[model samples]
Target chain A: MEEWLRGLRGMILESLARHGLPFPVGRDVCTGWAEGLGLARGGRRILYTSCMYQLYPYVKSVTGLLESLGVHRGGLRARMAARGGSLARFLARPSGRDVERSKAILRSIVSLLRRGGVEVGYLYEEEPYSGALLYELGLEDDFARHAGMVVEALAGRGVEEVVTVDPHTHHVLTRVYPNYVEVPFKVRSWLELAKPTHANRRVKVAVHDSCLYARFLGMYHAYRGLLDAVGIERVEDPYVTGKDTSMCCGGPIEAVAPDLSRSVAELRLRRLSALSRTIVVVCPICLANLSRAAVDVEVLDLAEVLG
Target chain B: MSWAEAFQRASENAIPRTGMVLEAYRYVVSWARELRKVKEEVIRDLDRYVEEAMSSLRAVGAKPYLARGAEEAREIVGDIVGKGKLVVMSKSMTAAEVGLRQHLEGLGNEVWETDLGELLIQLAGDQPSHIIAPALHMTREDVARLLRERLGADVPDDADHATLASVAARFLRDKFLRADVGITGANALAADSGALVVVENEGNARLTMTLPRVHIAIVGMEKIVPTFQHAVMQAAVQAAYAGLFPPTYMSITAGPSSTSDIERKRVSPAQGPGELHVVLLDNGRSRAARDKELWEALLCVRCGRCAFHCPTYMAAGPRFGAAPYAGPVGVMWAAVTRGVEGAGNASLLCLHSGGCREVCPMDIDIPRIIQRVKSRYVGRLLRTG
Candidate 1:
């Protein structure tokens, strides 16, 4: 799990850097995701949502899993098979409908296990679509029906629990859906779910509390605790805090109020000067914002905190 | 008003030959660029972190309320202040952002600003020029004369910070004890448990919130966080950003001061307020939230670190921008929260160092946001041409 998390962090960092974002400390990223996912227990079967770019490094692991499944496929085929049945075909087809169908398949798998009395631990759902599919479709009355379909499918497959890493999904499942109320839900970040065991030496760290974390979400301290445990002695930068009091970090607002973005960044840098010379950020867009700042401090993802 | 009209008005009203307007813009851009370089990875993990934060806030038993505009915020504040008197308030830029204090005072409540900086500004009959350091532009001589003029002879000439502080403390102590109501701003609000976090160096905020019979906390709707743990981290980030090792004090308020220690009943402490009312103000934030470029400005945690790090701000000596928010963020905030007319010209001075971004906990791309706003100003110039 740690290895996969490291790889994932590296992939994200590389992508962000390519886009001119700040670099992140690996361990901070790992701990944040670990805590978010509630995976600190040390024993759990964690399944990752895969894209070809993300699953590339796990080729050997996928190949082994596929071989165990009696499939002699190599490379890409093996990787696809390991994700589950029919995922490869969907990926190859590449259409909006295909994306929808793929989500349905995953949901079906979750429901099937729940029904089979398998006592599934958690389901990490992503964004835009979850149990709130009915709401999105403007069929609010069918919410119960759609929710039941998901629940029964997970239960039928012997999966007893479901969790979502996306707050929007969690909000819909826990707050919006009726059938989902019975299911124990833990909504968190991928970093919180994958805590790193190693710590970085002589490193300065800065944490960017995502707007959702500071304004909408409220898991600010958990992210801090995770960074502290990873041997990151300093955490700086505070312009984002509380519920609605936090700054937007120039994501959706990039198209309109670009000057406000600079102002927000300037505000954040003033806060960071007190913590450490290096910044260890937890969020991706923050990294992007900091990267454009072009300061002297070293910026790293939380995942890079550990060896 | 349109960004162009506001910019023109502000530029025209600005103190000539200061160059603060252009310098502020350059500094913000430079600071933002520096922050971007350091927090690259965090930008990628933004979506995940936001999810975690929102979930935690909900778990703590807080309700999410969206405000569409300034009118909505006024309504929320109106509900909380209904027929109240002898109100004592701690300094909060959020209140200033929506002009809550003036609005309340206009309603005839006799509001007293308890923070020394705020009080000094009130005495001087001027608006706050900075967020944290409200009277940053004033010198000891200026304060001494002002105090002497208002409070009379006993006030010393050459009064130092400590002496001035004591004088302010002595004057406000009675008000703290006698005030019927208290108003304050939150550093962070945990949504999961409904915890309001306030960080301060002075004990005034503590006294203000606890001493009054009815305590009112006016926070922006975006101040919500998911949990206490996240609030702690965010506070640390705020302190660091502001160049403080740790904020001198931290207060986590869940609700009204209550104790179940009494016999078969709850008893409130003598010092703590009995009733707590929270007023969540939206005031231009919903539009900011939806605005791709400007929304990032809403993520500011109010640490005031950006102003401290800004070279132009330091050189300009605090008269750099409009009241309540006086740095790079202040310039932009003035444009968005206030009309662009009076304070928006400060953005023209920013140098775009990206240093401010390096220290931001949320890593908002301040320079880019500033550029976007400026581009609009430029666009207006062309439209008129």
Candidate 2:
């Protein structure tokens, strides 16, 4: 492990343990998207954001801050930033514009689910971070403990089935959580539960397959099926969207190596822009990372396009 | 080239390769499963397999030597070749592992890597970016320049790939004829029959192993299989997943070549090399097999397909892993051969997207194992800190 990664790990673990989120952001940033959506407080089945989509904008901002600070180079400065050297101020808030953009995507997801005739409850501020980052960083012990906390929070709220919005949260809840913690709730992606009616408009978009959805959670067909059902024509290219060949959005390493992450995103974006000007993404991280690198292309969430 | 340019070129090269792999993937997947089982069984009792293989090699009249470390392996080959010998070598990760070429050269022997890509990298004095395609990072222009400068071959400024290949081929053909010794790596070693199987797309391996009077093979212990039939299956499975099914050539050598046609009686030292030496290089492989989290990595057949599909590998070129091992699987192999700390930074390049495991023929849980490697590295760091 590098010095900065160790420092960042310590900071993130402390934040998650203390505040139940990876950052020091407030509850409003998490539940604000559901403010006027008329979603119920809790139910047997619920829409679980896991705050990934909401938290990502903040993650994007902080990573940019870290990159600008040359934290990727790693040294005493990294340890100082980890100890809250103007970092807390950056992590304290995401830009209102970015927040609104993320909120609109979350809104689009809720609208799509509603149009699909699925009424679901939202946990709002009670929703816990999925600890997917912990799992990704090889912090299994911390992730296991965090998974227990997340499971307990959902179970206590009578949440029987989790309707996940993003692939990372979906995969962690469905495939990874069971290995670490005893889970009483059934987990499913909103893509599986939402049965949206056919769209009247025709559109062409390049669909970017999320690595987790395509390779791990097996939602490649489901998302493509949804696109087809909505009368959207996906510009297919093996190098861009092939199940085995599609590139990652580089979000996985954004925090540790933002420059490399941007490079990967640019590579993926180049493949996508060659096919279509409008790019559709299934994962929030993909949406964020690719959107950063996209110059002329419009990166939209699958829900934003479907709805 | 810049990382972006390198990444784009790699993607351009790998895209079609993956397409071809997908075409044969469904058919070869079952063979991959059985191959993994065979590898697991062999590694489980690797010591017994080593002894059995050595005995079988002796029975077949091939000298067998076990090297406990890289230094020992290099010294064993060095002593055999002596000084002032001309050597032709096929592309072998094991040979790279033990630094055999450098060591042999240090002993005052002339060595040439016969594979076109390996040769280009050797001329450039650069490490291999991808195992199968050593010079994947280099452009045709780059090769033309290297060949023109290093070999003084006649290559046009805008020479095509075929032109470039033929020029190198013509140059190496002379070296092959005059070579005093040939060194190669075995894809799989059959303990039952003492057969060494080498799979390749070019006929260079055949020439490198057969044209010389002394033939020496260096193989990692994890490459051992139970029988000759199993060894052939292993080669086929490796080639199939690498998107080259029905490989161009698979040479299965049980021992030194001999003729009995002279007097209806067995005769030694015939058309091929009169002597064959098999060096079984351990070099941390046996210890890796005993590691609970990492042993599955030994199941890798060195197909290099994972690098094709790995995002970081494609993006960073040789930067993603230790030399001679690249991509997701490379980090684990680096951990096995170079220790966990050596693999620490490289392992971090992995995105844990599960792409490598998804495409792996042996179905090795690459991400899980890398995480384990990462966790161990982190643990060691924290303890020391």
Candidate 3:
């Protein structure tokens, strides 16, 4: 998935340059304690928050690629238990190593962003994160304590925006966090941020609407409209579950129903094929699933299409 | 016929129990939100674009009249139509918004929709659900069935694609040759050159304008652009939005299809129409143009992209709204042109996705406009309450 995502990101960057649109690249930071212990220096952690993590091979591949790209492995599990539901408590078992690992990963991600010249911010007060585990471990205030240090560090560097793909992250930073951080922010999908620099010379394509975009974010048509403006002929995908009626990409259900997930992906690909030979997807999970399905069509991210 | 009577008849024919009205309202709200997000730079220069379009139309030897209302537009069209057997057309939702077809037909002339989709709709005895792709909801099987019923036993169910194409081709070819006049909607009209841009996959529009001796192009006043380049850009955007390969073909008719190729002295014997007429219908466009927020609805290129992406449209199919216009843009257009009471209620189900805005080449924020319409509807309800 990361291989594909990286390819998509590269395409978007190229397209943006071609179209004379703005493209900003930078680093981000998250400061939170796992279990009751703070993260030690030089520790490793695994981060799994996005629904995309449920897809095993794809997640493994993306994580491996990110690691190869110099990303640190920590125990930071960024997993969402349900759609807009609570974070998993099982991962919060008072194992000091687990906590330390999670923190290390978060720190590494932050460092990566900083190195890339991007600023970081945090909004970490929702769901189980604000519930009993941190409190039970008697380290409830550790998140705020560490977050303050990171925020201060970021402020001193004049970093303005904390770019995040998750709406929860955006909601926390913008609305929940009490830091009164006045930094202007951008909450967008990786595809939106990394649009290609080249004009789409190819005219015919179909967009497979992502559930996150259509259902949670209400952005089903915006992508289509943007593609249209960029001179790409958009064909209608009959199986698109738009907005409230959106169908899940089966990323979430993959843990319990892998076959069902694959079937859904196949069904979606078939519908998309009816529309066009080129299928442009917006979500990381959808890209992974459809790519794995081996559908005999060119699969691209919307940003890639723009390129 | 008065617009009031026409509207009454449309209301009677409307599938009142269907969910179209609610779905259309929802689309308006969604599109309105998107229009609001358009960059200020684009919104600020709208007047200039309008002026440019008006000038181009005048330059091409086409008259650009700004009618204040439907009644005024009726008088203008009535004057042009005269008593000489009113051969009518199928081109715009604006015509449907104002009920021009029935009115002209009532004035006692044979009216026909020459475009294959419009003709199919005419034969099916249905109203257009989308501004473009009017028959998008119908499958080939439905068309085959309808054709079989209309053409009788001679039409075969197992007929190949070529045979079916030849059938409709043969039927419309005769209609085109014999029609006294042809009417069409301008995708974009250059205000500076008075050139009319007609984009279509089929050659119906070309035949419609050229075959008839008297040619008429009807367009909303807002369809005007300042220059040919701007019109071309808009056309490209429309084609992209409509999901076609730059539209199967685009026809730019300046005056009529007259050519000097027939003679060395630059004289045409029988090529193109002798008289070309352009009707710049205002209907309720002027009213919409006055409101800064709702005015951008006039910028629609009638590409049908918004409807194509609309969730409600996908679920309810084309019959989801009132005649002439359907989907999100249609709801607002219907309201403005048809009346708030008559069409405002049609767009109650729109989800505020801001998708329509993102796709709009002109970047019209449709969701915001729909909200404004909803507010007006709410205010009216309050007043009555």
Which candidate should be chosen as best, given TM-score against the real structure? 2
TM-score of 3: 0.53
* Candidate 2 pairs with clashing backbones: none
Q: How good is the docking of model 3, as DockQ?
A: 0.02
In model 1, which regions exceed 4 Å deviation?
A1-307, B1-67, B82-84, B262-271, B315-322, B335-344
* lDDT per residue as tens, model 1, B1-385: 3322332232223322112432433443344344433223222343333344345434433322334566666666656676547788898887766677777887777788888888888888887756676776676778888888986636677778788778878888888888887889887766556678888888888988888877777777556555565555555555555544346888888766667665857565445776666666655555555566676776676766555444345334344566666766776676556544444345444434344554454667665566456445433433443
DockQ for each numbered candidate: 0.01, 0.53, 0.02
RMSD of 2: 2.3
On DockQ, the stronger of 1 and 2 is 2
Q: Whole-model lDDT for model 2 versus the true structure?
A: 0.84
Candidate 1 vs candidate 3: which has greater DockQ? 3
Question: Best by DockQ, which number?
Answer: 2
Q: Interface RMSD of every candidate?
A: 16.1, 1.7, 17.0
What is candidate 2's CAPRI-style docking category based on DockQ? Answer: medium
Docking tier of model 3: it is: incorrect
Worst 10 residues of 2 chain A by lDDT: A194-203
* Candidate RMSDs in order: 21.2, 2.3, 16.8
